[model samples]
Target: MAKRDLRALMQPAAAGMFMKQFLRWALVCCAGVFLAYTLSALKVNKAPSDPWAAHCLSQFLSDARSFSTATSDLKTTVNDLSAGDTASLTHARQALLRCRLSYKKIEYFMEYFFAYPVNLYNRAPVHEIEEPYMEYQSPVGLQLIEDLLYGEDPFAQKQALQEQAAVVQSTAADIPASVYGFEATGVQVAESLSQELIRVMALGIAGYDAPVCKSGLPESAVALQSVKAVLAAKTAGEQNLYADSCMHYLDKAIVLLQASTGFDTFDRLSLLTDALLPAQEYLNRYCCQQYPGIGGEGAYNYNARHLFRPDALRQAAFDRLAQSDTAAGLVALGKLLFSDNRLSGDNTRSCATCHKPSLYFSDGLKGSPTIGNGGSTRRNAPSLLYSSYQYGQFLDARDASLEKQIYTVLQNPDEMHSRLDDVVRKLDNKTYRPLLRKAFSQAGKQITPAMIARAIAAYERSLSPFNSAFDRYINGDHNAMNVSQRRGFNLFMGKALCGTCHFAPLFNGTLPPLFNRTELEVLGTPDGGSLDKPVPDTDSGRFGIFPIEFYQYAFKTPTVRNAGETAPYMHNGSFTTLEDLIEFYNRGGGAGIGLEVPTQTLSPRKLNLSQAEIADLKSFMLALKDSL
Candidate 1:
């Protein structure tokens, strides 16, 4: 009996000890797991030093030396050339090409560090006739000399050519000197390389830069060589596999250019898609792998499979703006404010009057009727649909932000003709006050102009629903487009050169990867569709705001996403039908239509598209209509 009692007592004591031991072990395991997680996170956050930046810097200096030498040779060639002599002129042309080749090799460096000076030396004199905003300036660059040399009377402009050559030499010499003053970073090199490739594909291949000479092919070859040089620099002090991948493609591009019979025969689209873009993608991947978070906030990764995407619009917005308010509440508030005529001075009209949802958010008029019987607006009322995807607002690109653009429309005498204070007072009613409170629920508790603008802008943004048939086709539904539409797509990207300006997907000039920058073109539109005796549109466009010669008559390129639906096209709403609008572009704007638009940015050559081809093109445009 005594032995049994002792055993029971021992069992209880042992059980208590075992429970304490198990708890102690669990605590130890948890502490070990926490320590490991902390260490792993620290390792992941650490970034490595980039070796490509230093390498690219050294290579740029070498390129600068070559460029300087070429420019000096060009100057000598120009000086030695005799007036009215064929051989001398031929030699001069060759010399000019040699200089251009050297320039093309280092075009990235010039475009990056010395954009202003480089413009002075190499800017194309396509339609540079007059600029009332600046001093009466004449076109003075390589293109200026090209016109003189290729003209019927080359000798007559000998002195002028010599002067221009001197300017070019001075510009080239300054570039090398400037290179030493600046420092290079890995992110900058990656960004510059991507931009350079895009320039090559867009401007260079389209013969925009070297129009007179048609030297795009050979110049592009030299540019590819420069790209190789850049890649070689990047490969230094790093793994060869990634850099070599890009180099292989670049080598293929150079070979393809070499094999090309002529400019007309060369497939620019193939080169862009197969070679250049892939190279850019690999380079981007390598950079990201080597140095995380190097390009700074909102900077493009450059590794996107496609050139453009609709979501890029939101990504480009500031983090604060993107996360500011609930989309549903803001959109609801915006919709109410847009239709409320009380926002105007006389309660006669609202945003809905001009931008009716029935007409794809356009007024469907040549020019929108004046807000208070003031006649009509000077320009066409551009469709609000998909406008939120653009980098800038207004034909003149006066407002860089959509929210800021609201003020101009509200206050314009011929539009809303209302002050912000008046609008705010009207909106400070029971209907709007609570809606505004719900929409904001934070900082915009009180109805101010900014809150009104933000709410309206939010509704405008909601207009871009991206449910077009083309979107479906690109997103894997091959049956979305007909054969004619497919052919038109090829022609648009290839022969028509529409993609050069109105970029793919969004079909606007907001450049891709990060669609933050807007581009303007000087199309030289006629006054009133008078092709027989076409008169230049009186509007000074971008020049009126910036007062710069380069910006003379420059208007922001609008999106052609719903061009089929939005009638009365162009900034002025001159064309009445799609055929008329297509014909204008086919004839290459005013210049091709027999107008002496010296500063016309559009290619002044006829597209020579047959009726059938035009029909196909129209079909493609029609396919861009949104599901809404």
Candidate 2:
């Protein structure tokens, strides 16, 4: 009887259970219909404003990796070809050149991904420029960024990266090299490895503040961090502004790499090697782009995104200690002293008074502060535009180092009329030293004049005289210069015979970096200073520094880096206009001004410059301000 009763109850329950299953299936089906409808609605609504925006971006990233890999493979192949002692290397070099052209176009697409369409009237605003930069990312950098941006697992992605690296390592063995390009040439692989490590670490340490990405459910977290960073930039420090996204990516990349396969010397060095330019270009473009409402480099109104990477603590510490720590405070103090008029006895001038920042830090005066003209200096004030890159110091090359040069100018009776002792006394009592002391804590009590000059010089040195239209032309910019600038540049190197003195790359007195001092020559300048009657200085030029006749009249070559700005022209500021200067050069040096030096190569060299040629020369000089 008990069993029969249980069966009766079970029969009713079984019927109820079957009905419940049918209802549950129906509900799930309904949810699927709702989800499909919602997604279709969103697609219709949003896709118009962003037509192919998502596709464009995804396609772009995909192409980026493909292009980078393709170029790498091409480069390796070309290099491998060059290794063979071919009957003619022309084919290999030609192929290499062709491949480079393609690679560069890819670089262009990467660099100006968001380049606004060019308008004929779209004159580049004050200094807004979208220049080309190489486009490539290290395997680690690429993988880490992917994981952060696309919700991929970092460790798994890193494992895939290690396998790719192993392939690259094997491929590298089969490749050959030229001294001019490629990251790791065969002979100095060891040194290359060391450099790569430092580079990777700089990149790695910088990644700490990026948005977090994981394979799990916190989809809103990255958006949240980026949003907060954008907001906080209003009151946050510059370091924070630059570091927030870009740095975070690097940190995560570094962490993932370490966990996947521990870094050896090669991995560390290689990352940095491949990364330096990309890191700088990305940060520079991102950090400096205008934010409309904000005044500083990193304005609060704009937003940009980058993926995250975690940097291990050890890596971070290593980079921080190894990197140069010339702080912003130092740059600020240097700018202050450089422009301070109070440093002079007459209180009439400052370094900036002579070196106008807008005019490429050159007054564009033939010479500055004309004592006789009741104007300032007579000769053109050569633009210090790239003066930091100048080897040897000063117009006459009287000083060897920046240390001594600052002292000379300060003590010179005509220029500034204040001694180093006086400068120290004036600044000693001022309230700037404490901040400096806090900065250079190690040099607490020892910070002195040399340090001050170096700091200023360092700021000056940072003024890299690159990015000129001429440089762009040389660096393969087909449309960089207009026909006039292009023609003028050609004339300068050839018929103008300017390269006889000013060389390429640095385009200064020497082919060397400013760090390695080299002296150069100009014919002579008119003896038209305070001495009404001429007393011959015998072109004693840098001979003031090295008491040698051969060195006489041999002044350090003023970097054409920014000669476009500094003017009056020459050591004594004889020429008034760039036109006059060009004419004088065409006629050949000081001869037109009654001072003649037969040995002056520039002297009366048949520049054969017509009125048009003269105009072209000036046009070329003006074009040089691209460094601005």
Candidate 3:
């Protein structure tokens, strides 16, 4: 081809390249236009750069912690703020004006809900949400909770259910979860205890005391002496030999319990009703002969519960759980998570450390020490055995339910001083998701404090060790206790007024549902004297919650069962022995004030126990104890 023809071909190729470049530039321009439009839709204009607003937001979070024991100011600020301090709450005042996060607000009130269920049940003061603006007007947080909890709208129901999750999460949110509330060992321990409780309750009536029983002797002195002689034996072998040797003679005892065959002339029913100690002894022997593992199956001891109410629940919840692999899987997964200390920020503790199963799921301490520098609080660490049955918690009766109680302890600086932020981070851990997914059959929305609380609560209810000698005695065991224990029981009910606080069966500080220890009372307890004028732990009692003079120096009343093992009694480990406590009660509690009076009509009159009577009372309390 000629030079002109070659230039023409090259010119066409050059033209195509120019067109391609033009189209590419046009497309780029269109894309930029679309991006600009999208950005504008978000209304991304920066707020009139208010340095004050920015400073306020920063200051608000710095000063306001969402922890339950939050300072009044901080508490006020968080409730009013809608956005997190990092978000729209651009000023301290703004953040302190409106609560934005639904979860945070719900949790804040949930703490109150569990703390005062009856109070809320009767009158849920809707204005509390206005706490941030208590002095002002708009009731934002309170309205939100009220709308959800008591609202009829579909949206409200949905919100209420979702709120439960937040409620559970709220407790441990402050927990770093380095080791499952590692930020606060007490929280971890309480959570651990909660888990144990849930697990125990699932056993259902399996561990509950049956009403059938044993009845042994009418003559209190003879029965008491006989039982004491057996007890005084140096070894388990000796006790057993005496029991077994007497088995032939026990025909009279057995007849006394089951029937009045030989005692036809006596009031057999009355004799049976009066034989607490003899009943305890008979049950103990029977229990030793029947089941092992009572006191570790050693010849050292025999738990009498087996004879009367052995695994007596009419319906075991675990039976339902065991029926399906899914439920079992969930429980197993929960058990693992419950035991995993890795949930802690530092892997230093788990739910099991303080709520060890071996210890009947209670810390073997007068009072659990604080996980932080704040130090431990007053009260003996109550056993977590019948926690599910508890109507109120702590020796001070501060918390109401297991879930809320668990949360309170979680947030307590002396307890679980853990940060919820840390817990969420760990619960959201990528590695654990698969296990959680398999366990719950659904990978839940990252582990929240609410989820942890509920899970632990479910687990804690399972720790009940039902069917003790005392229970058998109540059911039908006449020989469950000696004559002294029987008389003591009589005094406990008729004279001591113990049944008024600690109900039957579980012996927790409640008479079923609405009847609870939520009511405040001042025992006028003698101030535990120290080298210092005012002891460091002088409990102002419920007065700390409200400054009423009448609400002075009062604490919670724990269950009387298991009193033998859980020592160092009272609010601040004040009394060293049960005898001392008895004496304190006999003298009345306000001795220091020269009153030593019981504030309640139920008590306050001195126990007025004579020396012999004190021994009898002690023996009766002894009936409440049993192996875990």
Candidate with top TM-score is 1
Task: List model 2 lDDT by residue over 1-628, tens digit each.
Answer: 0000011112445335423633553464456446656655554422213322333333334534544454355334334432233522344233333332332222222222321211100111111111122121111222222222222232323333333323323322222110012122111221122222222232222221111211111111222222223223322555444435444544443344444331111222123223322333234334344222221221111222211111111111212211233665766776777888766766677778777788777776555673223555423456655454443567765555555767776676667777666666666653757755655664448446665665566456545546777655544465776777665664564455564456444456533111133435645555543122333334456556555333445555676655655655667665556776666666555433445443232333234677876676677777677545
lDDT of each: 0.69, 0.41, 0.41
| TM-score, one value per model | 0.77, 0.45, 0.46
Model 1 scores a TM of 0.77
Weakest 10 consecutive residues of candidate 1 by summed lDDT: 1-10
Candidate 3 stretches with Cα past 4 Å from truth are 1-346, 372-374, 427-435, 512-520, 529-537, 591-602
The Cα error of candidate 1 at residue 62, in Å, is 2.6
Q: What local lDDT score does residue 110 receive in model 1, on the 0 to 100 scale?
A: 68
Q: Give the winner by lDDT.
A: 1
Give the 10-residue window scoring lowest on summed lDDT in candidate 3: 1-10
Better of 1 and 2 by lDDT: 1
True lDDT of residue 458, candidate 3: 56
Q: Candidate 3, residues 476-512: lDDT per residue as tens digits?
A: 7778878888767655543443433444444544432
By TM-score, the better pick of 1 and 3 is 1
For model 1, how does the per-residue alpha-carbon lDDT over 369-405 read when each residue is reduced to its tens digit?
7876769888888888877666568888787666888
